[model samples]
Target: MAAENQTQVTEFLLLSFHGQPFLFILFLLIYLATLLENSAILALVSLDPHLHSPMYFFLSHLSCLDLCYSSVTVPKILANSLRPQATISYSGCLAQMFFLMWCAGTECALLALMAYDRYAAICQPLRYAHLMRRGLCVAAAASCWLWGMLDSALHTLLASRLSFCGAARLQHIFCDVPPLLRAACSDTRPSRLALHAASLFVGLSPFLTVLASYLRILLAVLRMPTATSRRKAFSTCAAHLVVVALYFVTANLNYNRSSSGAWPVVDTLVSALYCVLTPMLNPLIYSLRNQEVRGALRKVVGAQGTLRLHS
Candidate 1:
């Protein structure tokens, strides 16, 4: 029943890292930190009534996204660390790629919306509440989710068509676009262009949008009469800016790779930033910087701390 052009791949051998034994313990620590941080963020965001604001709303979603995104790969990675070989089934690899792309793209759009929210808050302070009304914020978040679903669905469709004749090894820990394309036996021109175009649209376009928004925000901040007000505005956006900048820098370095001269280790290091380290620290950064978040976290902790004390 298999089409001659379409060879069914039963499984893929994942090359997470080659011959690096010591890295396992380091990666375990990083994975645990990422999981705990994301979990803490989600709990605080969901449980803390004080964090019921547009900014923390998006941060909650981002934390949840990071948790899901990392989960698609990390547990398997840790499991493989306990063993020798790390292999995943073909359908599972496809699913992993779809989920990973969906989460990353959604996070990209979410960051842009969060930046726009900050712009509205700081640059047009009076209009902040009216502009970022609960309905609109909910709509914006829904749109990001829909866009992510659409992107994942399209890539999955294209991936379904590709044939894998013989080679089964995937060069990365997860089933990424590049490694999957390389592993395919059939012509992968369509898949490559579609995925890369999605990357440029989803990845590069957001970069430009963030840049433009921040430039306008900068101009507005410069015009403010009080240095104190300007400083306060800057502080609010600072953590978000840091998170976005760190994310975009590593993400671009990873996805914008050229086939002409590929550097695996360099890409690995950069990918690690976005994949492992960024998610691990994002919630902590925001919680530390934002008083509202801090208050909410305290409330959550105080409530729990009280429960423990009473028990």
Candidate 2:
């Protein structure tokens, strides 16, 4: 009887915020803004000589990750809002989960790298250049990318082995490990263990690294002789600190909740904040808080205006 009742599910119904026109328009606007902001950051970091430091190098990568991260989920959310029945194919869902985890893990590691960059610049000025040399920076960034890919590959592999016996409707907004595990009928112990392991290493470990880096930075800043130096040091770290707080707080809320119950509205809002809204906010935070980025933006705009006049 159990065998007879078992049915294969080829598509998952994404019922969260389905057929909501207001949300469709809102997400469309947010997606466009996210693209514009991240693209501008990439252009500024690449073209502007002033942003050639280790800080903006990591910032550019952060913007890239934000772009990929938002693209993975927001487009689908916008499409689902317009459709009567929002659905994703089995393969599509797995692919989404893969890239989503990839970007999330990469961003976590990248943020930690950015913190260390600041710490080196502030706490060890004498060794800053040697500590963050070009080759080492490139290698470190590459390692972070590799770390994220390997972590995502393991979780995606585990998730693919899950067997869904009946309806496979994910309770949350998008394809993610938690909801997928919830929907599976097979033994989820391995997947759950993998998730717990990732939560520790990929998520919590990076956060702890960031915390430690900033703590050292704080002590160094306090030891500085001049107020101006202290202020300048704090200014350099302000944007990254805000971004770290925003990303980790939302991530923990989204992933670290108790697994026993469901709150559809809260879950959807938190997911949207983490996946949709945060990307749009990151560049804004950087540009507003960091004078270098704003100066670069002005230079780029002025150059464009001059080119138009010359033409």
Candidate 3:
């Protein structure tokens, strides 16, 4: 195929795993549950004054990100699963990639900021108030959002320039970075280099920050005089740690595994896990594992009950 005459792809087909009715129903339920759970957390945090700490502030943003992150791709997947041939327009694919990348980068930075918040609260309780003021928290969160959007914009700009002369069938459920690069007929080394650099910035850098925060947290916990204090300190960090581990582990596994050549099932499963299941699990980890979130939830429920009774 001549470089100048190669056919430009207007759309691409997403190949899913068999597209069973049961699978579609299952994914639909999971997606709906993710939306409801994350939305509820956001609402509760917004409405409850007692939950207005830096921690819950980050949690609320985390919920919002997860809700949006899942929304960027899951509904499309659910809709696609029911179709005879799952297809997405060129613009739609680019939009999906952009939004997903933005959400992903934002969440990575947000998680690091959340870790620092925990570290400040636990390791430096006396100065926690000074360290994590409203202005600082808002600035941090805003930086995460802005940086993520910038990263996504750059990625989309580069990716949109690539030519596609071969089959337009994507071997995964969504328009992920790796598969899209693979489908490109043009040389993707520049794009791949840019992507790797972005990953290092948005992904690995934050991961290392989280690790350092946890290390400091551990040293602080070890120095505590009482077991009760140690347990309390550790408890505050446990949920975030679980989330970080799940996210980094799955993400590293998915992306670090050969970008072009791999078993499709393994790739698809890993992609689904970090992309779909992680969002669903995040709110659950926060709400179920944190007492303040539980109390806030109960208060919200109780308020609703009282309003219903009065009505």
List, residue by residue over 1-311, the lDDT tens digit for candidate 2: 33333236688887656656677788889999999999999999999998999889888998999999999998887777778777899899999999999998998999899889888997889999999999999999999999999999999999888878767788877898888888888788998888778889999999999999998998988888999988887776666677778788878777777742287678777778877888898888755457889988889999999999999
The estimated TM-scores of all candidates read 0.90, 0.93, 0.94
Query: What CA RMSD would you report for each candidate?
Result: 2.5, 2.3, 1.9
Candidate 3 C-alpha error for residue 216, in Å: 1.1
- Candidate lDDT scores, in order, read 0.78, 0.85, 0.84
Task: Say which candidate scores most in TM-score.
Answer: 3
The residue-by-residue lDDT of candidate 1 on 19-132, one tens digit each, is: 576777777787788888878777877887777889878888888888887787777776765667878888888888888778878988987887788788877889999999
Q: Summarize candidate 3's per-residue lDDT along 5-88 as a digit string, tens digits.
A: 234677899976444888788788889999999998888888889889998999889999999998998889888877888899
| Order of the predicted models by TM-score, top scorer first | 3, 2, 1
Which sections of candidate 2 miss by over 4 Å? 1-7, 225-239
Clashing pairs in 1: none
